[model samples]
Target: MRELPYDRLKAYEGQPVATAGAGKDLVNEPMIRHWCEAMGDANPAYRGPDAIAPPTMLQAWTMGGLSGHTDRSGAYDELFGLLDGAGYTSVVATDCEQEYPRPLRPGDRITFDAVIESVSERKTTKLGTGHFITTRMEVRADGEPAGTHRFRILKYAPAARMTKAPERTAAAGETEAAEETEAAERSKAPGQPEARRPRPVINRDNAGFWAGVETHRLLIQVCGGCGTPRFPWLPGCRGCGSPEWHTVEATGAGTVYSYVVMHHPPFPAFDPPYAVALIELAEGVRMVSNVIGVPYDKVRIGMPVQLEFLRVDGEWELPVFRAGGGVAG
Candidate 1:
């Protein structure tokens, strides 16, 4: 299979996150109750037909919640620029810290702003790995300070290829296309907005998990509700009535139930002819993961899979399922 490409961690160093919009619409009562119940915080104050938004509900809002903005266009542009210069390598999110001042309600007008708090020196591990951390913060509901969060993102630079370029070049063209190959290997930092394409803000909830991937762990929600398992970490589970659930360790063993190879993925980090997979664990649960351990041309159906934590962006290590079963050949 095609190896995942390099990811950029400090893609937005020189620009703003541009969190503008009118906020998520919380219309249906059942939906509000659905969220509240998931948190196991079924307070009467949050119950009625026009119930309030639960405390933990705001974290996932960037995917689809409301305040006063509906876009992250400029933010994505900056990210691509950063990633390009940093090498098309793996990026991931590793940690997050949050503080909430006011509880989010159904009718609150929320606005958010994001900024990279800092970027640290890159470190190489004992395993011969290179990585760094970029921390960012997002705060909502300006006047009252609804919520504030800081995410420590992790990213890795792949092992540099020792392949050499062609012979020396002069204006007389003594080189054999080596300059072109050498230039291609170099990362490009974006100097202008038009230098790159835009994507969506991955949001804070799953953002942490994405970073966790680089740390080599499969972090999932151990539902506070039904003791069921959930991914894309949220405050509660949709299956049962518990809200106190937290994260637990996963062995990352599963079977491939479905898979798709993308010749055209919208994300720049992904290469063409790649496979996005649906893996069903022995526990009877399925997760959306990418299958490795085979060529994109060699990927097969029903392949046994295990989890792999790869550093995608910043400190976030992503847990993508690999096709092979163990650590050795």
Candidate 2:
């Protein structure tokens, strides 16, 4: 039997990645304020004199910024070196999972310990063949367990791009007719695989929002206790500690409160250089969605937009904003 090239990577499991690590900054108001501003999250819970950090900011406090942690062990680097030597030179962060046991407050100090949790067997993906490396970091605030962060990354060689078919020269009329026929036939062909955008994670908490999308309506969740509105559909209200909420259909009018242009690590389902906007609805709640009806460069803060549904593929529809005062659908 032939041995697998990645079989040796299994030995790296359960190794120490970092220990006795300390965060560069303590939990403070300035960082929390910056994060809130960037995310367009005006939740009052994150501001003021008694403010606590957002639960999702658990990993931010522990990050060493551009100058990485000095306490990181060499085992992690050695593992990467081995993979690089084997031709898997490219790296991409796949995803991260975080669990917060306690709310981090201002003046709380942060410390952490991390270990290489598990290494997956070599797997082939659209990006190429590579092994998944998972690291689990245990975070503490003021010497008490506060949270855990699990981060995963893929190191793989880039896949060769598909070659385009050569163009044929002929009379314009015949070429047009032939091309139209070919496209029609291709669309009707059986067992043809099509690239699709990744489906949004639809769980109980946000299922109603997706349901609204299917009907071409945008619904915002309103807290029954405080009359405050929220987007991205959470199960409970962040204010007043209320789990009771109701849905309200938005007026479909909004402004581009903020936006970012994506232009790297292309995905098959999305073109690069597209604008993703943070839209502040007329209801005064902000939601993130793609901006259409204008070039990526033309999207700007305070630009007025109208709501519409984007049919990305056969089975999925997404709520998007169309800029330049187009009628709302």
Go through the candidates in order and give each one's C-alpha lDDT: 0.54, 0.79
- Using all chains and alpha carbons, the TM-scores for the candidates as numbered come to 0.41, 0.79
Best by TM-score: 2
Residue 290 error for model 2, in Å? 2.5
Clashing pairs in 2: none
In terms of lDDT, the poorest run of 10 residues in model 2 is 180-189
At residue 202, give the lDDT of candidate 1.
69
Candidate 1 to native Cα RMSD, angstroms: 13.9
Off by over 4 Å in 1: 1-94, 125-138, 154-157, 161-238, 241-255, 260-276, 281-283, 287-329
Per-residue lDDT for 59 in model 2? 90
